[model samples]
Target chain A: MNAGHRSESVPNASRLRIAVLAGGVGGAKFVRGLRQVAPEATISVITNTGDDLWLAGVRVCPDLDSIMYALAGVNDAERGWGRAGESERVSAELAAYGAGWPWFTLGDLDLGTHLARTSWLREGATLTEATARLAARWDLGVSLLPMSDDPVETHVVTEQGTMHFEEWWVRHRAALPALAFEQVGADRARPTPSVLGALASADAVLLAPSNPVVSIGTILGVPGLRDAVVSSSARIVGVSPIIGGAAVRGMAAQCLAAVDVDVSAAAVARHYGARVDGGLLDGWLVDTVDSAVVPELDSEGMRAVARPLYLSSLEQSAAIARDALAVALG
Target chain B: MNAGHRSESVPNASRLRIAVLAGGVGGAKFVRGLRQVAPEATISVITNTGDDLWLAGVRVCPDLDSIMYALAGVNDAERGWGRAGESERVSAELAAYGAGWPWFTLGDLDLGTHLARTSWLREGATLTEATARLAARWDLGVSLLPMSDDPVETHVVTEQGTMHFEEWWVRHRAALPALAFEQVGADRARPTPSVLGALASADAVLLAPSNPVVSIGTILGVPGLRDAVVSSSARIVGVSPIIGGAAVRGMAAQCLAAVDVDVSAAAVARHYGARVDGGLLDGWLVDTVDSAVVPELDSEGMRAVARPLYLSSLEQSAAIARDALAVALG
Candidate 1:
């Protein structure tokens, strides 16, 4: 993927209501930029719960926290996860007690949120309710709705046997060749009312350039979430996490390989397919490095366009957001 | 009361087995000294469980932790509680969420212990079992056993209504004018087998200079605990937290007032009364300033001795421990 920094800043429409599907780092950065460009727009994010897990008697939602911290401006911008100025005293102790993933380090500040959420959950509050209470502490401009209130864990089946997605990603660094990716409880989970409402009432639905096989893929795996996006009156557009023949970030290349898809922008668009041909995408935005496939994607009725997709700064990211909105609103 | 630290350092017998009933700061200090004096003795501390409470979804035993930290050499000596080299970032965040005691702050290093203990308890470990798991992490010289495995909270009844003991002692600084002391659920609680066995087999039993009204009193209130102490053949001795007409530290004077006991060494001894007179104490160690009551206590069939009761230093505390042991062993 070429990390060229070149793009024409486009003017955006005012106050357009939009819903976004997101995962962790990449999604957080994209949404932060999207909010920068459309500061007055009513934004709703449907976060994937597939990465949530019970560790040390506390429920940790990686994607949910990543997005929350990024939006609140308390996120570690350099590290791309957890709160800024965090200490690992509690996590170090937890590891000493052999209670959690040693590799999955949770900073003390992040642990506070987990501990508070666990308290609510233990006292019978659903995931959605607990998240609301946590979100209330921050002035996150957008409403964050989990894809479902129910527990849905993504697992990777490797030759070494199946493990939680975090263990595969964080612990193993996806070194173990995965046989399959399964959203363990997604078959029983339904989209929360807020998620459905966000999709139904939005003018446009955007998918952040997160790993499709695990993040967005896992969110859509929730029983009724994909159907709701497909049925929504909003035009559904996606930004390719991949540029050229590799992932922009994370272990998406390995995930794509495991799922038997070529690590290319074209393969991913076809994976989402065209909404006109009974798939998810109405428009697909690819980075300029992968512009050669734009016409083929357009000819396939997907209405593809290419632009510089490097999120090197807030301004650059906002420019990409403007282009996505322009194409969706066109 | 006696500013002069005048006491003969009595030689302790090697490996004398003893059991101690203790509470927070005073108890922790005394135990640390006791371990120093009798380095090879089998010491088991039956910590007051009434100070235990559920805070932010985690079961926190202040007494157990205090003793454990003290014995492990990790206790904060300056403030007399929590760990040394602590941080409060997580605690500040928890307060922002409105989830825990705003006044009683838990340091991040201490929070690590709480989180691990909570994990064990949630996984079906009994309070006793959870405590054992925590104790295993430290090289604590003495065994810190909770008085009982049940949820026995000490609540203070006041004009402002009833509140947890920590709220009264820590938050309000015991200023609410407590009407009565309550050991809630102690009636349904049974001391663990370890606690009973420790008392049954010990060469002597000790009441640390913790607040008699709430600390030692709460342990004695546990169902069958007082009976075990009285029935044990071991000579039971008590070191007065009260000296002259004042408590050594803490809000013991307020607690003593709540229990209608005059804040004097003689008064607390009378409150426990003489074991021969169907009460708990067989021997009592009062400060040299309160030596005037010794003859009267001796005549009442309870051996009374006076020593410097202030635990101002490790050497001073060890001298007090040696004096208490001498009186019991006589």
Candidate 2:
């Protein structure tokens, strides 16, 4: 769809209340692009907190910090995470003292966010409230919400042992083959009120190009969150993290293999399944290289569109965001 | 007495099981010098923990760290506190996040120690065990023991309101007139077993040139610590922090005034009182500039000696330590 047609079909394009489900780096990048595509739209992000962990007594919410820093224009674009012009003196010191994961470097600036969050949390603020307090520091141009107020850590079961997802991903570099992924505490985890409200009132919902199993999958795993998204009247569109037959970033292929899923755009779409068949996705966005999967998605009762999904720059990301929004509108 | 005669009187001086009561910078410097003077002595330092507090969820034992870093040869000599080559990136970030006292800068390397201490404490280790664990990282020749394993935060009662001792000292620079200093939790805080053992079997006990009202006073306030020192068979000698009528460093003068004590070497020695008169000091060493007070201290039933007490260099500090040890031997 063209811009003119999109504006005509989506009457209040500038005022559209868009909600996004996101993970860390990829999710943050996609959300940044979405913000550029619809500058005036009310964007609410329900970010996955499964990757959150306490390091050196400081609560570190990787996904939440990534999104906040990206939107605040301080994210290290080159490293693709943490604050720009960051220093690791604290991390090095922590390592010297044998505190925190030596492999997982927490930048000085990034630690500031964790300390702030931990302080608030200790002062009796829930995770959601602490996130809101952290986000309030910058004019993020969108509302950031955690998937749940309660703790829900993602633990990857491997041949060695059940390790934290971060320990598996960062420390071991995911070299250890995972047996399964467990969202510890998710059974009792409930979506925050803001998350439910955003889903219930959103004009459209977009799933960023985050890891399907650990990111978006974890958000959906939050007891009531998936049901809310499924029941919302808004059309839900998902952008594939995989292009061709491999993950666009990180170790999504390893994650997919652990879940016994093929590392392909078609497999990911099918993993989300179809909203018509008691699943989540109304539309699935795939890269042009995976255009061949459109027919299979359509047969599965989900619309599939192919586009240049690689977000190398803001322009490219905005273009992809426009495509996802177009699919949601359709 | 001359050094040669003093050495004759104190046989096997190098092997003396000397225990020193200490606070932060001044105390650390004195302890470091004492180690240089008697490298083979079984030195046990009972460090003050009243200044210890939780900052950004990390336990910060200022006095213990100062002595540890000093003895480990990693202390910032110029600053007389914290680690050498330290960065304030984390502190700046913490300030930006509004997580800790803006006035008190926690160096990156110092923060690592806090992280380690906090981690150990969380894992059910007492402050003594945590200190031991932290000290194990470096070859600190002396055994460092916190005055008490239990928490004993010194809260300064100021006209404005009660504030943490650190806030009163670092933030206000002791400009806020303190009505009194309260060693909160000291009533239940017990000196660790090691502390008691060190005192009981000590050949000699030397008091570091630290604040008499807060540093040394707070340690003595720990329920049984003062009694242990009083009852110990070993001779107890104190090095006055006051030279002439002023503190050698920091706000000792202000602290002395708060307690309604004269800011003089004799007054402080008298404040500790004579061990014969139910006080804690057997002998007192004062700066040569305060020699006028020696006769008065002798009249008060406490042996007094005058020496050059300024520790501007290691040599000077070593000489001062020699004098203090001579007083203990006498």
Best by lDDT: 2
Task: Give Cα distance to truth, residue B223, candidate 1, Å.
Answer: 1.2
lDDT of 1 at B121: 86
lDDT tens string, model 1, B1-330?
122323342344445788999998899989877877777678899999798888777777898888888888888989879999988988888888876778978898888788888888888988888888888888877888999988899999999999999999888888999999998998899989999999999999999999898889999998899999998999999999999899889988998898889999999999999999998899999999999999999999889999899999988988888878887887
lDDT of 2: 0.88
Please give the lDDT score at residue B208 for candidate 1: 98
Model 2 spans > 4 angstroms off: A1-11, B1-11
Clashing pairs in 1: none
lDDT of 2 by residue, B1-330 (tens): 124334423357666899999999999889877877777778999999999988877889999998899888899988768889988887787777667777888888888788878877887899899899888888888999999999999999999999999999889989999899999999889998999999999988999999997899999999999999987889999998999898989999999888999999999998998999999889999999999989989988889999998878877887788778877875
In model 2, state the lDDT of residue A172. Answer: 94
- Fnat for every candidate: 0.66, 0.68
Q: List model 2 lDDT by residue over A1-330, tens digit each.
A: 124334423346667999999999998889888877787788999999999998878889999999999888999999888899998887776787677778889888888888778878988889888888778778888899999999999999999999999999989989999999999999988999999999999999999999999999999999989989988899999999999998989989999999999999999988998999988899999999999989989899889999999989877887888889988986
